[model samples]
Target: MSGLIGKKIGMTSLYNADGQALACTVIEAGPCVVTHVKTQDTDGYQAVQLGYGEKKEKRTTKPLLGHFKKAGTTPKRKLVEFKTFERELSLGETLQAADVFVEGDFIDVVGTVKGRGFQGVVKRHGFGGVGGQTHGQHNRARHPGSIGACSFPSRVFKGIRMAGRMGGNRVKVQNLRVLKVLSEQNLIVVSGSVPGAKNSFLILDK
Candidate 1:
């Protein structure tokens, strides 16, 4: 529902009231501008499209430039539609991180995990591989071993967790506790790690 477009600012440790160190991922959220508003009577749905970050005019498409122009805002790097909002907002209005979230709130962060390129099963799927070095195991330590049956199935089954491209998948981390909110800086700190590499875009939803 209510959400904001943000960029991953990496992770840091914060000391809590009990003196316990909490690991949290820092995100630079919002100052997002409302680009479009979809109404039920017109678009058959209720949603608000928010834009965050800035892109060079040359790098942005012409149609998108026209869209941003209609909103009275510069070109934005990201655009996301949210179904729910705290209150009805007008187009071209800006929202900061503190407007949508607060400390101690539970939110979901959606992001893409870092791509690991082509990976082997041992690292990608956590296969233990062949144990021990004796018994003519040789270099088959990290091999997937038997993949298919002798004759009954004959071929490898679909959806098998073999080696292939790893990571770079969209991941949703839910119920992340909001540790701190710096409204002035447009920053939010949440407990635990979030997906994606530093500077990657993320969607924080409530």
Candidate 2:
């Protein structure tokens, strides 16, 4: 599947062709550079590495500096590899949002979700805790009740669903419609809420 790398620029409402106001998330999609192209014979695969977002030279390391220098491009904050794309891509080629997708195209967006740290079972796993609000139940309302057997196992299982750190995982939302593509500004307005917060990296694929 072909795709483009982008950054979430926040949400806004825009008018459709029918004059209906639609809520959308405005994203600053590519104008990305094809940093490297992997060939089947050489790299044992076919893929293109796209570079997005700019960064200062001081923020880049020596090894990355060398890599970007070889590609004849400035340092980018994110570099993502995309497989299953159209064949015969060359290095240093510029990819824009207009070229990858247009209005009404269906795409899959991949991003990392916002992190929620150290949560309880109720919030994390949607566990309906013991006791009702009508009854005078104590402070054990949202707690995880009785993890396991005591004398039988004597220890907690390895894969117990205890609450801890949540979110911050890679999520792919499929079949989202591209509402509009602003070519001049390199922006794209997609139909629904995407994963992650504003300014987060997003990968849009077919």
Top candidate when judged by TM-score against the true structure? 1
Give the per-residue lDDT digits (tens) of candidate 2, residues 1-206. 78889999999888878999888898899889988888899999888999999999999999999988888899999998999666567788888898888799989999999999889989999999976766666777888888999898898899888789999999998888998889999998898789999999999887
The C-alpha stretches of model 1 lying farther than 4 A from their native spots are none
What global local distance difference test value does model 1 have? Answer: 0.94
Best by lDDT: 1
Q: Once model 1 is optimally superposed onto the true structure by TM-score, how far is the C-alpha of residue 6 displaced, in angstroms?
A: 0.4
Q: All models: lDDT?
A: 0.94, 0.89
Candidate 1: the clashing residue pairs are none
lDDT per residue for candidate 1 within 49-166, as digits (tens), equals 9999989999999999999999999999899999989899999999999999999999999999999999999999999997878998888999888888998888889998899999
